[model samples]
Target: MRPFQCLIIVALFYCPLSAAIILTPTVMPLNIDKGGFAQFVITNNATATLPLEVSVHQLLFEPDGSYQSATEPAATLMVFPPAAMIHAGQKQAFRVQWSGVSDLPASQSFFVRFAHIQLTPATMPAGLRPSDTGVNIQINYNALLHVYSDRQRADIVLRVDDEGSARLTNLGDRFTYTNRLNFEAIDSEIQSQFETVVGDQFIAPYTTLVVDAGLTLPAGEYHGREIGF
Candidate 1:
């Protein structure tokens, strides 16, 4: 009898083939006082040229916090290079400009969608049919683009937990950044307290955040705060 061999395989599914495209600082902040302009950068990390279709979408946040595409155009924001190609190992900046919409509210948001656009001037495969000609690899990404008239001033309310998610609420007009969470815990049994620094994260305006800071406080209290770098 012969012994049988086993094999294991891994795959990168639903990802761009030859993907070398990346958008840095995914979370962007816009200051209307700063001339209503923000910059987003895309770096092509692949060895082949990267093609993309970039467009801006207006957002309407539902009562349940889920947002949907709005018919109202993003008249305030305009992104150039709606369609472009990036050479391998190169970087490109997409400028987001505001057309000076009058009486702008405290804040407004948009979703910048980067879609795959295949580029081929002349190429054909053997026995290619019309249906096969339309086939191309799909690779895409997007980012959260925020344009606000005011800076973030959070009125935060925090709740502590030892083994579960800690809750935080912002009662202010501005959103609280999650990356700024700090934790201090006092163990009732040992009577000890310690502090920690959390990374940059965000909580929307009038929204709540539930996070687990991995604090082991048995029969004790926990406290969390935010820090600005």
Candidate 2:
């Protein structure tokens, strides 16, 4: 658990039409559960009035691999202030609760999208700045999911040319860092324990220490349940 205070920088410039607002998570693929509760807080940093649409939509990937959404079409999730407005530089918080169960593919990742609309109203103040409508919007979503089997470990093999010849060694205490894989850690406490390393070369579990000339590669992608001593 962490106390989060994220600062989003959005530049507002003078424009003829409404300026496009940018919204995203500090990290990719904000995690949430299928049947859970989530609360999102939207901050209005523009110098003009803002009308935002709060809802969820099918996640879409942008040309450059970013994400964007305008609204939610017939989503089962319930959101507060379904259609509302926010003042310039002011902040508004909303709560959302989803009631459904979804089964994601094992060892796979997925994503969902939420949209916010900026609104301009006819109620004009006596003196309001006419600058770019750039505003920073941050989402704080929270969800709860039923815990599945919490004791599952994956046995991944790090091989060279798909051959069964490779070396293995642990990096740190309870943490095994290997090569050739970019793994993103979610809500799991991960650590690698260093087993052993033999000189510049690696030793295989129950295999020869030498003879092939070049040193064998490293294999540390496999994981298993920790057996209590």
Candidate 3:
């Protein structure tokens, strides 16, 4: 399998509109040893019943800080109830399980997408009138799924350049989840110290992340701390 690399911005929940469908716990982590199963909840807040379709894709990250996904129907992961009908103000639960090899060499990442299926006049619920004067909106959500083994480890190295920029490299076989990065700079002539912090980021195995520390200092010696995995 190819290594996945991306800068993941973690969010608590997804709700794009007032009457949109809500998905909770956007990040799902599964352990391969202990059954490798997890569940997520989806709540329908719209006025009409929602028809949803679920699909699984292998998440891929590009060097240009973009994301792409490829469908893997024959993969080890399984999603229960690939299609669902959730009534307004009702909640549905979906199950995801890893049924692949028992001994995974490294961690894997996937994106489980929940998309709204448009309702036609023939498919609309009984007594529900199709909106003719108002705009209809559809929202889709993608939740991150991380499958890992107990022996997974992340080796991240932080390097600072002379121009006050920073680079993070992950040499290990697992993904590194970093919340913050701290760096200190010293100005010899002014005898002053400066510190900068970078926001949350993810570094995948065998990938390098170039980021700005958000601080510019005179040419001087600088040091940084490796982000905790």
Candidate 4:
């Protein structure tokens, strides 16, 4: 048997024949301000020209692992002209944003996924279909929830001098620091939340943890030290 065949037999995952389609961003688990926007680039590797669809959904996972979901409607972008099309050797970009919906919580974590996408031409002829027709893309983004708290808490407080900074008074009282902190970024067309992990230093419980960068931060109304755990 072929090497790929043997691996497929071992894994029990079927492989498709069409050329693979890939999506990439300069940075993923990409950080954006709560009410901010981010742009992503998508590239096609196949020789045929194709039209595409995109959509996004948000999922809220509680500390206990319970969850809720919000899915968006299907969206078809402007017809990709043949010359302006995503050729086998070319790439294109699209913009995505967080609507600033108040339902998101601060200092929390959730999953964002892409769902319901398929490729088609701006218009297909009556009886012609590309060998690579009907291909689909699915990807997801996993991000953290952030909220800026104004009220004073026993363990948490805002910094006096630094902007967008917070003070953590005592970490041992609430959070058990994890050796590994993992985050994920969602791609709407692919319906998958891909993970990316980063390293962290000491996050003092009572001392301050300054969050200066406006990235995928847990937004709004989190309990003191709840995020530490």
Candidate 5:
């Protein structure tokens, strides 16, 4: 099991991001039955105070193993402190609550965008020095969140793709994170044991990942499983 996980989706982002904000708990895992609530802390590291805007986007997993973002309606997910002005080195708490969400396909996931609200010059500190302006630019951060059905669990499916390449698919709801993958393949009389570091890759449910073995793995019986989360 990985202690922390992130996502790797190739898509055109509908929104922009800044670099001034840092979010703890980069990923959110929720139990749809347990009040469906999760929290994240936003910290501003810039020298100037930042006006922060918190928002959520529905993550649509496409067939080609990519994700598309759809803006979730404000009423769909209740977020507290949706807007706040955070001073440099200050922290603000935000909460996301999901209620009465049904008719979902086993489960669903979204991304929380910690966007930056431009700080007007008038809002800037009077004591700002020239160096300060150069150092404190707004940087935004994003966190992945998932709301799962009670049946949400991880199911790993592997298939041999091109030479030395394999495809890993998660057939269950929720993000299946693994620090290491144990699988083997062989070509000709040469056999090799290989491990792929999935990293913080949070593979969305019902999606497939083409894992490159970096070598020519022949067509043969390949076996392994996700060692842990």
Candidate 6:
């Protein structure tokens, strides 16, 4: 008999192909005025039992339009049942509460990581075993969690360099979410246009997000405009 092997897949966002586990409300918004906490549901769609581990991390962004996750202390946020074993077709409710300072002056962002642990015949329920192929797949998902106060607001500005490269800077006290950017420039009777459609992305406060304008133009000053905030 072949030994069962586990393959792990990590997805920054939700995985559509694997329905073994489903997490609802990929974007969770918590208002400080409304208790600064929220709930998320995880459903097991796989035929076999699933074990899940939950964790939270601080979300950070780089100037080059890239982002990373930083380790967050447990006292900053509270999650109930950080790990659980869920049966097939069963739904589990998880509660997240903010245990940090209650008087937050701005909005904060975090990533909720849900990992589906490896499965084996020994861990499976009675009468359940791996197929003859003896293979199991594990998946990890990262969900966005935003905690904001009443004073949260976004002030975004667009700037274009002499080479026509464009970047967006958020000067406000909170993050700005946008999906599209539109800009046009003119240099000595020559008009250059640039536009890009980026699916949901956020510009954190006091950070610059660089985007590919996809156009090369003569050296000149260009003013960029953002569409559909």
List, residue by residue over 93-190, the lDDT tens digit for candidate 2.
66555533344222111122233333233322333333443543332221111111122222323222334343332221221113222223311322
Worst 10 residues of 4 by lDDT: 1-10
When superposed on Cα atoms, how far off is each prediction in RMSD? 9.8, 12.9, 6.2, 15.6, 6.7, 7.8
TM-score for each of the candidates = 0.62, 0.38, 0.71, 0.38, 0.69, 0.70
Q: Over the stretch 1-229, how does candidate 1's per-residue lDDT look in tens digits?
A: 1100111011123434324467766667677777777777888776666677777766554322345655554666778866778877888888888776545544556667666645343321224443666666444465666666655455655555555445656665555555454545534332222223233445555655553455444433344455672
Model 3 steric clash total: 0
Q: List the residue pairs that clash in candidate 3.
A: none
lDDT tens readout by residue for model 4, 131-221: 5555443323222222222221224322323333322223222221222222223233211111122123323223334333332333332
Candidate 5 TM-score to native: 0.69
What's model 5's lDDT at 103?
A: 44
> What residue runs in model 4 are displaced by over 4 Å at the alpha carbon?
1-19, 26-35, 66-68, 73-85, 101-229
Positional deviation of residue 53's Cα in model 4 after best superposition, in angstroms: 1.5
Which candidate has the top score in TM-score?
Answer: 3
Q: Model 3, range 85-179, lDDT digits (tens) per residue? A: 99888999999889899888777777777766455655444454457525443446767888888787666555656776766666666765555
lDDT, residue 168, model 6: 61
Alpha-carbon local distance difference test for all models: 0.55, 0.33, 0.63, 0.32, 0.62, 0.64
Ranking by lDDT: 6, 3, 5, 1, 2, 4
Q: How well does candidate 2 match the true structure in TM-score terms?
A: 0.38
Model 6 earns a TM-score of 0.70
- In model 2, where is the ten-residue run with the lowest total lDDT? 1-10
Instruction: Sum up the clashes in candidate 4.
Output: 41
Residue-wise C-alpha lDDT for candidate 6, range 117-213, written one tens digit per residue: 5557665444546774376645576667888777767766666678777666777776656444343544432322332323346666677766555
Cand. 5 Cα-lDDT: 0.62
* Model 2, C-alpha of 161: deviation from truth (Å): 3.4
